[model samples]
Target: MNHFIEKTLQLKDPNITIDTEKVDEVKVNGRFSLIYYGKLSYTPKACECCGIINNAFQVVKNGYRTDSRITLNTISAMPAYLKLKKQRFSCRECG
Candidate 1:
């Protein structure tokens, strides 16, 4: 569950959701590692580019960027990582 991961990782962001669909277990440098995927998405209250309120149209979802690789404290002596998919927002009024 998303809450389980958030609690475990001590994440305070409500917009972040842990994607447990397919957890990756890979070998790196001859050692095994675990990778967790997380997605960050939220509607913007205001446009950062023009400072205009969303109002259902001013700002819109602009898809997500590639997952970023972030190192985490090793779990049980094995390396751990997080692949975060950050959402993008575009301001229609500014564009």
Candidate 2:
């Protein structure tokens, strides 16, 4: 699992630093979910013209499952990115 996380981080951003401290595991619906918390130097929601900044967003909840019945079964890793918008701010400049 650690290796998978490492590979994911590398694929996401090779230059930015990843906060392992914020990384955590949770059990939901009897399935294991991995959570990652970190800040990207480049903001995805930043306004191109005004350069106004937007509040940080949380990534999506990701999960994976495997079946042991099949011989040499290759279960592809599941990838998901969840973004929750903040309601506190309604910035016209960045909206």
Q: Return the TM-score for each candidate structure.
A: 0.87, 0.33
Error of 1 at 25 (Å): 1.0
Instruction: Report the lDDT tens digits of candidate 2 across residue range 20-88.
Output: 555445553565555454333433465445666545443221232221111111123423222112222
lDDT of 1 at 80: 85
Q: Model 2 — TM-score against the truth? A: 0.33
How displaced is residue 20 in candidate 2, in Å? 1.8
| Tens-digit per-residue lDDT, 41-90, candidate 1 | 99889988779988878788889999898888787788988889999988
Which residue ranges in model 2 land beyond 4 Å of their true spot? Answer: 1-5, 8-12, 28-30, 43-47, 50-95
The best candidate by lDDT is: 1
